[model samples]
Target chain A: MTYPKSINNLISNLKNLPGVGEKTAERMALAMIDFDKEKLGSFSDSITDVKDKIRHCLICNNLSEEDECIICKDKTRDSGILCIVDDVRSLMLFEKNNLFNGKYHILKGLISPSNGIDPEDIDIEALINRVEKEKIKELIIAVKPSLEGEATALYIAKRLEPKNITVSKIAHGVPMGADMEYLDAITLRTALFERKKIS
Target chain B: MTYPKSINNLISNLKNLPGVGEKTAERMALAMIDFDKEKLGSFSDSITDVKDKIRHCLICNNLSEEDECIICKDKTRDSGILCIVDDVRSLMLFEKNNLFNGKYHILKGLISPSNGIDPEDIDIEALINRVEKEKIKELIIAVKPSLEGEATALYIAKRLEPKNITVSKIAHGVPMGADMEYLDAITLRTALFERKKIS
Candidate 1:
């Protein structure tokens, strides 16, 4: 028998989330019954509040509540060196491990022609303008090592070429602690090609 | 760099969902930025609406919008043949495949002593009472074939023994389309023990 309308509605809406499918959505809907009313209220409020309050950082395209994001507003972080990433998640990843000391520019998307996402569709022009206005010394493209990520990085580098700005993409090779047998040909090839000499 | 307050709140709230960990919650919260205002509003409403509108059916403990669940309200189903299931999920699974034509009684909880749950905590009394009041002739215990499920089924059967009710547990065997190589020893033993001869 079909679930009541309310439950079915929840299942459908839950499917809207990334990586959530029908079975997972059903599980989530069923699990909700165990949650206390107060928790549910806060959870509901949490989802709604983000939409109502959060917006883009006018400067760097990072998600923010105010006009400027936390990073943009912070004077402590060095702003001269800008690290470009695909989205807020990538920006957060770089921040989490204290890997990068420079400020960030979130593209919020990458170039993928198959998905109809063109170079102009993303925030490339805004990035170029940010570089010029802020007098950024270095642009480090730290997007994931995917085809689309490479395309976006290359496109951005070409755009900044005329302005005589230094553009560098993050190194792509075998990851740390990865098993050699499991490494794909492309990664192994790239690792060898970009290998550093210790002599 | 930390996300703004709104994003951080959403991330924590998303973590409240079953199977969603810290990283997944962060991913979900970041993904929410792609959702439009109207979609976000409805998604938020969908979560809250279920809590407001849904309740347990007094008769069978199935989740419902009204006092009685859809299955309990149906007069066409065979009320005499009652099926005892672990929860609404099991009830739905049985109903989905047209596997059972009988009425259902949701236990909602099983006899898991390790989890500090006992027979006294579950709705077994309601189930026993329903069997007598409704004159249920056959009780098909269809709970999952697990330790807690067996204990629960045994407890219910023993309780109803004096009433002369015909209580039967569903068979435990290797499922259809299952590969023999991947089958666990217990399942293989069960399949062999419960095997039916065609000769």
Candidate 2:
């Protein structure tokens, strides 16, 4: 009840984040208190910098330092193939594993109608526009295989079919409701290679 | 492998802490990346602030902004009854429950000979001097019941016995080798209240 006001404020702010409880916040606070001043300052600065400098790529909606992310900027990658993902984190995972040599289109979220997030609310239109403009040869639907994921994939596939692009979803070997990052590199590569087109 | 230098540095630093492994570090790193810029800045600032501004209280070895901690500065607290702890984190647990009304003496570390941490390496001399100079009536050992903890308690007990002040160890109702933070509040309180004198 009588904690230092600044410390209490710090703890309160920390509590707002997911998975961080009071004890965890306190432990983090104590760790912060123990960190060197310059490192702590940089740590604080990094938080704001990521928010201010990082944004959805104008071209693909993936996290980007400029109008487009590094993958979009890299000339070596296949500009004709676009991997559509549910979030920037997936894009990062792909980039980390070097599994995808193509460009990415981050949806930023899924089409969860139950959560009031419809297809129109996400970056589906931008993705469609990108496919049309770029004359993309392949559109890989890397979205999760939940009910919403399936619905979104089908919706995107329907929209892209007329455009003559070869649309496919990653294989179902990844267990349902599992995170893509948890899949080992070999498994992920296999999933990507064994992808099937929607009839 | 090709993460932004700053992001990589942060992940590396986070991974260096105890209990945080590769997956946890990745999760923490992603959380930092996703955190609101302003809040992350504050969290970073607090880390440095804690490292730069916080130091061991001169009287009791507890961390404080000044030479003495709030507990040590309070005229109402029973400084004459020093509560000896192995680390500042343990002292905070007592403070969180408002269990102890006395001032604390943090050893800053435990006595682990294999780890090269001995009684002399900590503030044991300062504690002995405080007992000798002050009208200290009781010295409560709140260290764990591990082999190291028992050794530290016995070592400190021998040192203080000549001064005639009572030396007591927290009760063993707490199962052996249990961390103070994990103990339930009532059990911890009971342990404190039912402490037995060592000398």
Candidate 3:
């Protein structure tokens, strides 16, 4: 009886979002109330709308409100140059840099054997079909540098090799401006071994 | 063309939530891809559902899915005792403690002239009406001891002084089990000021 039922309900609903624990949700609910009744109502509506209306594009499995996302439908994108990533977030990070004109294929997940996530469970089959049908000239693997990411990249690389398509990986090395002395032995070795000749 | 349109839209929607900034929203969007797609969809839906289904209770401006929230509808709560809180989050915190058995009235905000918030902006009138109609015996102010909170409490006390209602503020002093040596000057002063005679 102390809390109006709606306030409690809103707080509980907020818990559904990532990083919103109970205490944080409560704080958020209070903040919403402070914004005025109308805004509080909007906050509630927005939460539900995002959940209901937003979905992954069926083709690329990227967040979308339609069947094919904007990137997939855009004519300006070079469909032949595909960048494969472990999640939709990585694609966004790349887009923020505005350096790539290629299309993206979200893997949805990596081959995490410890967690029982296998490559077969993700959209690998769709990726293969996309490569074949879309006449993709290059498949650039840009997954994280974790063990699972490396394994997934390798799996995808092997799959694409049979079609005679160019399979490349974004190089993993010390970040820009990082000192060479601080670099780990394995990374330093990889960077040295894969060094490209500067023309 | 850079970020899939759907992903961008979804991230933008996420940014509207309480405590969600651009960076946090981006991280959450990416994390969503790692979770079950269906669950992510449902999480978004829940937000909209809560917004549409819930509203403020007419009597107390507390959150409610119905015209009157669960607390307002309940027959068991002591209507005579009303606990006044500056924000709805305080109500949630008290609910976690499970100590109070009375009803609650959320002010929605505290009186803060600096931030352009005053008593008129909140549900102060509704609070007075509830007190009058219910013939409440004790009104316990459970707001924080912040400058705004203190100012709000003083304002509410003055307004209710004419009503002959017994108004009391919650205690503010050293937290239980906290060492006195570790306590700052403000807390020490509050502890000394709020000292109760023990038998």
lDDT of each: 0.89, 0.75, 0.76
lDDT of 1 by residue, A32-148 (tens): 877888888888898888989998889988888889988888898888899998777788888888998888988868999999999889868888889999999899999989889
lDDT of 1 by residue, B1-199 (tens): 6888888888988898899999899888877878999889888898788879889999999999999999998999998999998878889888889999889998968999999998879968888889999999999999988899999999999999998789999999888898889999988998899899999
TM-score of each: 0.90, 0.81, 0.75
Whose DockQ is higher: candidate 1's or candidate 3's? 1
For residues B13-132, write the lDDT of model 3, one tens digit per residue: 667666799889877766654556566545544444555666767876667778886777778888899888865557767777886878888887888999999888976888888899
Number of the top TM-score candidate: 1
- Candidate 3 chain A lDDT trough over 10 residues, lowest sum: A40-49
DockQ of each: 0.76, 0.33, 0.28
Q: How far off is residue B122 in model 2, in Å?
A: 1.5
Candidate 3, position B37, lDDT: 52
Per-residue accuracy of model 3 over A1-199 as CA lDDT, tens digit each: 3445455565665676678898888776656544654554454444345555567777777777678888888899888899988776688788888878888898868888899998788768899998899899998899988888888989999888889899988988777999888899889877889888999
| Model 1 chain B: worst 10 consecutive residues (lDDT sum) | B25-34
Residue A143 error, candidate 1, Å? 2.9
Interface RMSD in angstroms for candidate 1: 1.0
Shift of residue A136 alpha carbon in model 2, Å: 1.0
TM-scores for chain B, listed for all candidates = 0.93, 0.78, 0.88
Scored on chain A only, each candidate's TM-score is: 0.91, 0.83, 0.87
- For candidate 3, give the lDDT of residue A136: 92
Task: For candidate 1, list the clashing residue pairs, or say none.
Answer: none
